[model samples]
Target: MTSPYPPSTSISPSDMAAGAKKPTDLPQAQIDAIIRTKRKAREPKACYPCHARKVKCDRNLPCDGCVKRDHADLCSYERPSKKRAQAFESPAGASTSSAAEPTEYYSYDDIPSRVKPENTHPGPDHLGVGGRVSIARDEWDNVRSRLKEMETTISSLRMGLERAEESPAVGPDSGSVQSAEGASRSKGNSPEREGIHAANTFGKGTVHLGSRSVMAYILNNKSGSDQLQALLEGGILPKLGLDNESATYPFVDLWSSDMSSFDISAVCSALPADGQCRQFFYYYRDISGAIYPVIEDITKFENDLELLLAKRLEAGGVYREDGDQAQTPFGTSIAYLGLLYAVLASGCQSSDLGSKERELTSQVYVCCSYQCLRMTNFLSQPTIEAIQTLLVIGNVLSYNMNPGISYVLLGMTLRMGLALGLHVESSRFSVEERYRRRHTWWSMAWQDSHFSLSYDRPSTTAVSQPNIAYREGSQPGDFSYFETLCKVISLALEVVRIRMLSPNAHITFSSFQEYQERIRQIMIEAKPYLRDPQYCSSSTEHLERVVLKLHSSYFCSELCRPSLKPSAGRADANTVAMRKDCVSNLVTTVDAYIELHNISYHAARSWIALQRAISSAFLLAVVEEAKSDSHVLTALRRLEGIIAQRASSERAYDNGDVATSNITSSDQGMASYDPVTGATNPRGLSHPLSMLPLLRDLAPNLKLNGPNL
Candidate 1:
């Protein structure tokens, strides 16, 4: 059979059936058909070298390419089979085009693009279905892991504190059975003992308790145990088996900042040059200062800035004719730099730049601030500056559509506040220091409460301590209004946690009315400032007042939300009137956002503002479905207009279309938050917080923006 052909190319029965025949017995056409069949069968899966080079594959387990390249061991033909591809099909429905294609033949880039899923872009609601499912699974794993770690850390810390407690007092009278307080008091007459006790007891300065007995004595004297119990019972913190001795004081070591984790040199190198930093700082001072006045003593802050600039210049951060220094000295306190970076980050976000560009700019500064904070060991040291920096970081996160992580950062700030004794109103620190502490405490509370509401979680920063009245001639510049706004928002948050989250919970109308009155008083106090032209002489003042009013209006909307809920049975006339009033409040709230956007479109797009806008729009859309109102329609259109503007700006920026006309062009690209009926959320079937199962296969075009949504 192989008489005329080479022995290696002998035609077997299978080859004969495939049209192969002995060369002497076959026509040229039949021989050519056989050769083509052999060539097609010889196509190889890529060998390692060929794959690495991105050259054509021969499809052989060990193709001639691999044999010639001496890479037989690196050759592979294994890939997902047809059955495996079929398994990837979702239960809802397989993507028909995708399903018909062979898995092994397709590259990831070969997949055709599809339409974007609803609500997955153009705004914060960008957790596409596939992304949401993946993030849920990942966050679930992380939460469980963190919980376990917290449990272990808490248990270990408690044991250490307890063993320290069991040890006898470490002073003059050895093993005397005097109470911890009596012992501490006896030793406190000494100058050094008194200072340590004062600092630890009132959170004045450094809490340097060398012995457990001293710590126990101080804690007991201050009734620290009772405070811990109150915090746990009030649900201000997770029930983490906390001992008062451990809870009230910073562990000084546990969860302490890791210095090595920070790379200051890298952060500095990544930062925009010194000139850009100054520009951002000025912008922050002028604009963001009206909202968050973190840096109180501007003069002292500038002195600190000089030191940072010198260090940066020395580090080759500045381009000067004199040339850069080979070695740069490390600044004493990275905390100051952290604050500066955060301020710049905030300023960049609020800038009149393209969204993508602004985000990138802001992100760089945020990372820089975060790095500086970590390098300075901020967790162990609770300075006003450090707390302020944390607050800024939280705000930045929320602004970037990341509320969950922001909430975690805020929690850390709260814990730091506790460690610093901001909760106690003692005269241990200077009057200025005391004022800073008070403001910082309230700021933390506001952030905690607001973020909790956004995430539908319980408020964690409880304000159970007696309020410290702001002393006359002591309030920082323009801080009074900011403080007042925070106070009002904090009160509204209590309503949020109690009513909106747990609507069925029992509460008397009298208490509710009392809460309402508190809000009313705040609004009344701020009314003159908001309404009086004399009070708001400048644009900043006017804008601040507008922000204050907007928040108050939003608060009123939230306060009336519960009453607007459908009743189980027929509602009375009073109930019906209350519902109508609720609708009116919602309309007013929407109007407030519209008004804010008109006043400052840049400011209106801030995280809190955008959240309020989305919330009101969603509510109005729902209400409109049941009862049509002209006001509701107007509000909806206005909200849509703002969203459209944002979409247009973002699209123009992304497409490199930076002309003013392009940005101003009308856009219909607003993402939807189409409300789901009942208690379900729009995205997933699972509880809003829980991670839902993912689809087996992601459509080719779906993009996921992960947990930020």
Candidate 2:
């Protein structure tokens, strides 16, 4: 598929949906049959729980055997509990209370009258299992194919000062070979070099060049998102009780500012009108090294861009004298790493941020979660993808499949969310209204048809000032939220993490299956809550405006809207020089997302904040290993400063009476980091810095909030 492959010749799987039968308006008798099928559990497979309890032999079986035999009272097959369960069968026809709890299901009256079907959803744990045949593992080759489509998107990057066609803002000339002493001097000894050169020799110790070639962009075109949307909007999903309201809208923004500001004119100043700048667009990379036609210059530009990214991260937006503007989702998820190329391809570069601390770590997860959440909403609350994304990045997943990272990261986010009191203690929506709002967040983000409630905290407890990693260059857990918001983070992380075992791997596979079983139990128990069908209608106010995020389609279809498709318009020989800045722009654009995610989401959670800090440390190791990814290191240092300052700021605010409940609940919500203004004013931006000077000045101002911004 990565071969600039031809289109497929198969019918859309949805056009012939496997079970798109049984008219929308079914007879009550048909409903009754399905309902009866659900109410009366199937013979053997359904009897395991009861058999484990060592109950009587009447079984709900032989078609009403339990009901016929007075053992109906013991026929507890309805609802399941999520928190705990596991008991063994005994030889005698007696049972013990070793089982966690009896099954729980929605009572007939508990369900909404609007639902055409009765209370027959088998509660949560055993959702949609009956009256439906399981698809074979091979049957899901379509999903694997979709994943293959995703796999074509991997790439690696490097950083440093290098030779340029013209004098770049940073780095000495590469082809102008340096003598040993000249190279040995660090940043202070020479204005032309830094403490960086000790590592950036490009293939000696750390800076290993790409061994071979493998870079390709294989676009995906086979998603059934439109049909899924149709199903969702048509109430088909709600009808199936798959309509769960999501508790969060990850990014605060709707539309990312368009690319109206970019200018490719300057490169024309030195160009011969050849298409080299344009030709670099189609290149791909594999294991073997494939040099970009524009790499010599573009790579240096990447270093320059990191300086810009630092400013943008501090400034909270981009500003270009040439009018090139780039934007991203505020709480960018993991997939936003794709922006690494998008920006690079646009001829803009970004910072290295060491390895893990930047947007690639946080934003990558954000993007992955965003996509996975949407994918889950499309498929039935499948928690596996988000888990896998987190697991793959840092498989610190331990025996229970819970990563210490997950614990720290998720716990941090939850704590911050609580302490920030983001939507807490207000004249907030009632349960029903909150459910509706959650539905919009879910629809926009995940297309989920269930899971209507936010991760709930128990009754209002007097919150204490939590602990944080407030010091400069602190490791994880440096925020005040880490101690208080434990339950929320622990549970959410537990849910997202347990499903991420690599079944194909030797260590995690068997346990992975067990994890799957555990998740099956948890989700089934949580289904009734997630599949809250009270939210059957799509008439909520946010519904019309909420655009559901879906997987991008490479092939053209009216159903999918086009994402960023920039034309390096009218490139001439000089566009190469100008395009050199593209790597920098890409870096800034990306780090902007990273900074935003850490600040906006993870920063709120103490544990997650600390987890991110640890990731940042590891990433710093990666950067140190690479030796010369200076921009990345600079970005990381800048980020560390930003994080410390924010934490300190929040710690101060939290210490103040304003963080207290007695101050009047009306003003409870407090920003740990000052809100970003999305400042467009160039005055708030670097007015006009010389390329060389701007490159040299990497000192970031964490407290300098833009006035106009």
Candidate 3:
């Protein structure tokens, strides 16, 4: 071999046995070039999509997996970069050694120059590779992190389950285990004592006692309980279904109806003529406005209405006094429209329009008001005007025999008022502004308290500081009526709060008696001012007096209702006497309600007054049936007579007999009206012996004799 080959290419016996030269003996540039070539040759065999998804491929131009996935166009292979490969190779002496053994091929890691000593596995950017491998690495790290988190969560849940299994089972008498555990943790106190402590703590936050409702008390009585169950089972009472249609207004799906079709022009055209509008406004100002006093500036409101009407005539579309475009959705103009329509609706209800006309016209205005409010997105962007509009709408709905809907609207209005900081007194504002805010917030509180009592639900309106001030002198202004009303309602709410205390707590009979005394004291203080000859001159003043009396009597009876239940333990002589007094208060309450209906046209159609009257009568009937007292029976009969008369009048109105149905004074001595001041003649209205048929059905001893019966 030495004789045939050149001296430079000579192969010795040792070199032949070794098969190849060592990689360390080679040049660095040559080693890098070889590693690059090996990596290029290790390219994926499948198409790019298949490789990325890690799926099997047939190695076709458009692989079967890619075709199935509807991505055949993206099935081309990714070729190794020639420029990257060339950058690593030295221009000269970069050729491969043919004598180099095939088994000694270099891998990427074997190239010492490509990797740093500190980091054996460099990033893809450092390695000059494609993004596919980098993405796969990142996803793998994410999966590992998620698995660790799941393991931690599972361990925590397992520990909780083990603890739960070791705990004692709960029982009705012992209360919930969590409650027991919470009680036991409190500094060595017994579970029962701790339970009472916890309940008392919870009761401090509650504003109403749902369990102390009149219906609940009646059901607590054995006789009334059985009769009520039987009546409900026999379907004697109307089914209380949650449907849209009602006797007062037809069902209109304002929530789902197409709002794009709303026409401002059509809404304007539907408004009452200017003269009629003024008449309706005056009617509301004298009746509902006199009571609530929510609108502080009547002159400003009237001027705004006139300006709105003028602008509507000039613009031929939605008009904003603030120069906002008609196309703006949540503009002041839309909210103003809602407010105006709501006022008009309430006024219409208070007006002496025929029964059908009142319902139909008020219904139209209400729907329009709702549409405008929705268009303005009042929930997200509440304003003072929007709150006022909602208050009026709630009042209108409450009287329209829709108290449930009215309550829901009142809740929304409360939230809106809170959002505008109306519930809080701010010294930063002007005196006028502060008074206006106080007026609105107190009105909401008044409405909310009454509604809460009516429905036996919790009130959302919390009493805040800086109470509305009463005038100092004996002479009473318009504010005097509202202030007195608020005082009475506040006392009633306090009674409700006390009743919410836990049964296990140590509440004394003296506490309830104290509340009853407070209610009486407020009524006494109000009587002198309320009966002032100068103050009681207007129909509004007279109406206020009657309403104040109704609330006082009803709430006084409410404070004594619990003692009537047998489950309340044996009653002492004081409790027995209190029960008799409660019955008398119920009679007075019902009578005052009847007088309210007689004096005011608005009260005649008010569902709130009607509901209060009926509930009081029912409670009276329940007590009379339980005790079989002749005095209670006589009081029940008188209430029944008044209700029967009102029901008959409503039926006549429904039948379109306005002449006979119109509440007026007559020689026959029906409900007498004072036409001059719009109040009832105190001497004319009388309660003849009668009975409600429903009450008779509920209590068999009740004798039915009225025309309604």
Candidate 4:
């Protein structure tokens, strides 16, 4: 190709071929190269809109091209990124630097061209992959467009921030609103000041925030300042650092504080007639008393009671059928009366009396007991009478009333016993006193731990300090059974303490095995007592032992249940085996409880046994797999039979068909009623153990039978 313009030396091809004058000292090769080069095209310099539209733009504030189209304001000569970068950079100088020259600030329309350094480029799409700088044109354009939009948005934000910074600072006269600096300087800002500050800063839109921007603004504002202030002003908030729940409702004394003496005569008048009282008393003595040896000297109490009853019945030859008395014929001491009332109430519960009659009679006894308790200074020191009374009342409430309430009373009993230093073994006390204290402590501990387990909470009983073990040859009759039961209970309590009480307790296979081993040893120690040569011959004794053994197995089941629960991570083979063991134990427990009802079908029932039976049934029912097992189904049916029988009796009573009660001749007391022994006829027996509140809650589920039923 030939050059359009002549080079430094003009040499036409024809002239060069002719070798006519050498063109001004230029080499022939250079002349030819220059002539062959073509001129490059000029780069475009129009705005994107005009360029895209292919229109000629006379670039102006309102370009001629845009003005012609009636969209002059849309004529943006300023590139988006440059305009945004100027806005962002402008704010810092305006807000932060007093000495910044006004001219140094660039307006949006006057954004200076930024010089990018040589070899600088945006990051590659894939660095070093085939040494590529490859990017599709559309993608590169999209990225550049997004970058410009982000810059513009950021600049707008900076401008808003600059305006906010220029807003008036809160002054001392700005109502109750304190400056941020002042609020911080103050030792403690009362809730009032904090709330006022939040209102002034946030409520008034001091940050010049839009809806989208206000979220970050509000979150960064002082937290809960307004609510705290309101609570404080209302005096509903506790003092700083106090537990909110405990402070909200202060403790109120359960016992009344009148301290005035109660009329023993009035309380006695509330008691049933001599015959009825004797019936309740003798029933309690033989049945409940035998189980919990709360009575200090049973022989002397019987002798005194017999004499009092005989005199009361004679009553100067009045021969009154009602035997209504204005005063008690027996003792007037508050402790004795309290003990008597508690005994009567518990006995009535265990009797064959109709539900309405039992409830009413028991209530009267409970009131009388309360009256005597209020009159006496039982809490001053531990007395044999106080221990006996507390135990009886606690047992009554446990079996027939709310277990939660019973649990609370047990806590009180434990606290009272501790107050008397029952936990600390003492030689200063008599042998009888020491023994009584030991039993009392164990009773409270046993009750607390058992209920605690059911509640899935920690027991109040602390095994700190010196505790007494049952002395050999000291236990009368099957009292040793209770001792053994306590041992099992203690072990169960320890398991509960480890697994439930400890906040972060982890149950490992080794821990599970260790507990299983310990419980097994305890069970072995208890086995002989269950079939003790001393009481094995007596059916009543044997039954009591059976009940004890059943509870022992239940404790073992409880100890194993935690290990069986599916853990958070991978399953351990050992855990699976332990779970099988747990299920087997649970099945065994259900069988044992069900067998009790079968053996003593129409006998006086123990509330503890009922509770254990119900719990075991529930345990089986809950395990989805267990529902299909024949053993579980059989246990559930037996439990259903027992519950249905009780419900029928209750329904009969409700229908005023009291004569149809299941409390027949077969519904004998723990011991046979013998006139020679001063033992009264037994009524429908109630248990001494509190029924778990869970039973009532689980009623719907318990009533829900599987297909087998």
- Residues 1-709 of candidate 3: C-alpha lDDT, one tens digit per residue: 3597545434455543544554355444444444554463343566666664555667767765665455677776653233334457676755564223133222222321222123346442322212111223454467669878996886688667556644654433321112312322223222222221111111122112234455455544565666653443333212111111243442253444674566555555565656666767776676666656667676787777777656555655443334544643223267777777888887777765555577677778888887777677788998777788888888777655455567667888988888888867778988777777776777787778776675455666644434553533523333366677777767766644543332223234676578777765665566454645354655666677777777778877776766666655454776776666677787788777666765664644455555566677667656653346665565556555555555565556667676666554222223333433444433211111122456656545455354444
Candidate 1 lowest-lDDT run of ten:
687-696
TM-score, ranked from best to worst: 3, 4, 1, 2
Candidate 2 deviant stretches above 4 angstroms: 1-594, 597-610, 613-617, 623-625, 647-709
Clashes of each: 6, 79, 0, 7
lDDT of 4 by residue, 1-709 (tens): 9989866644466544544455444444333333423223233355544653556655545654555454566677445554555667665454433333123333332333221222546342222112223334465567669879997886688667546644544333321223423232222222211222322221221111111111111112233223333422332111111101121111121243444644555555566777777878766765566555566466877776677566545665232334564334353355776788898887787566666677667766876786776666666755656766877777666555345346556677777777888778889988777777777777776666666554445666645424545654634333366666667667766765554333334466787678778766655655454755364655445556667757777776665554433232226677667666766777777666555544443223555555555555555544545655777666666555445555555557656775675343232333433322434332343322112222333334445453323
lDDT of each: 0.51, 0.25, 0.57, 0.52
- 1-709, model 2: which lDDT tens digit per residue? 3778776334344423643333334344344444544563332433323443333333323313343333444445443332223343444633553342245444322321111223554332222323322223453456558766664542111111112212323354321112323232212122111101112121223111110100000001112223222322222211111111121222222222332222222211211112322222211110000111112123533444454445445544533233333332222322322222232222201111111232223332233333323323422332222322332222111111122223233333333334433223334546433433222221111111001111111111112212211223433222111111121222323322321221111112233334435433433333132223342132111111110000000001100111110222225443332333322332343244233333222112222122223222222222112124566555544444443433333334335432321111111122112212321111100001111121122122112222211
Please identify which of the two predictions, 1 or 4, would achieve the higher TM-score against the true structure. Answer: 4
TM-scores, all candidates, are 0.53, 0.17, 0.61, 0.55
Candidates arranged by lDDT, highest first: 3, 4, 1, 2
Q: Residue 572: error of model 3 in Å?
A: 0.5
- In candidate 3, how many clashes are counted? 0
Which candidate tops TM-score? Answer: 3
RMSD (Cα, Å) for all candidates, in order, is 34.0, 32.7, 23.8, 27.0
Model 1, range 374-473, lDDT digits (tens) per residue?
A: 6667877678888998888777766665554576567888888888887788877787777777777777776765654443345656435336335445
Model 2's lDDT to the true fold? 0.25
